[model samples]
Target: MSDTFDAYDDDGNRYAVPVRRSYINTSDLSGPGRIEGLPSFHLSGGGAVNRIDDQTFEIVATGKRLTVRA
Candidate 1:
């Protein structure tokens, strides 16, 4: 699994923010594995998750501080 981040309005309205994307290997999501190559935004604090489309998704991580845009 991977993660990504986007800015949203206070009313939960998504805006045009730079879409940050990261890639995590399959092994990373299997069991208890470590995820590498994360961005600084994810490293700050709480992460986020969003549904991009029917088959696509965005996972933000608070653990390693990274967002995987899948």
Candidate 2:
């Protein structure tokens, strides 16, 4: 997956369906390289938080990873 790593669109033009991404941040309430909690809090078989900005949140899996308190 490397047509010279294509993904430019600002008058450059390049998009041939090449995809490969990754992200697994726990959430320390910060930004970038985030990893704090959620190893097993609440998530039976469906787990997905998905939010990279505005506080930050990224917890995805087959299951197990979701917590909340005060």
| Cα RMSD, each candidate | 10.8, 18.2
Give a tens-digit lDDT track for model 1, residues 1-70. Answer: 4333444433454432233556565454456544555433322234444545433334454221222234
Q: 1-70 in candidate 2: lDDT tens per residue?
A: 1111222233443322222233467556585574333232112223334434333233455322222211
Candidate number of the best TM-score? 1
lDDT of each: 0.39, 0.32
Cα lDDT of model 1 overall? Answer: 0.39
* TM per candidate: 0.19, 0.16
Residue pairs in candidate 1 whose N, alpha carbon or C atoms collide under 3 angstroms: 2-68, 3-59, 3-67, 3-68, 3-69, 4-67, 4-68, 42-65, 43-65
The deviation in Å at residue 36 for candidate 2 is 15
Native-to-model Cα distance after best TM-score fit, residue 39 in candidate 1, in Å: 27
Return the lDDT, model 1, position 51.
Answer: 48
In candidate 2, where is summed lDDT lowest over 10 consecutive residues? Answer: 1-10
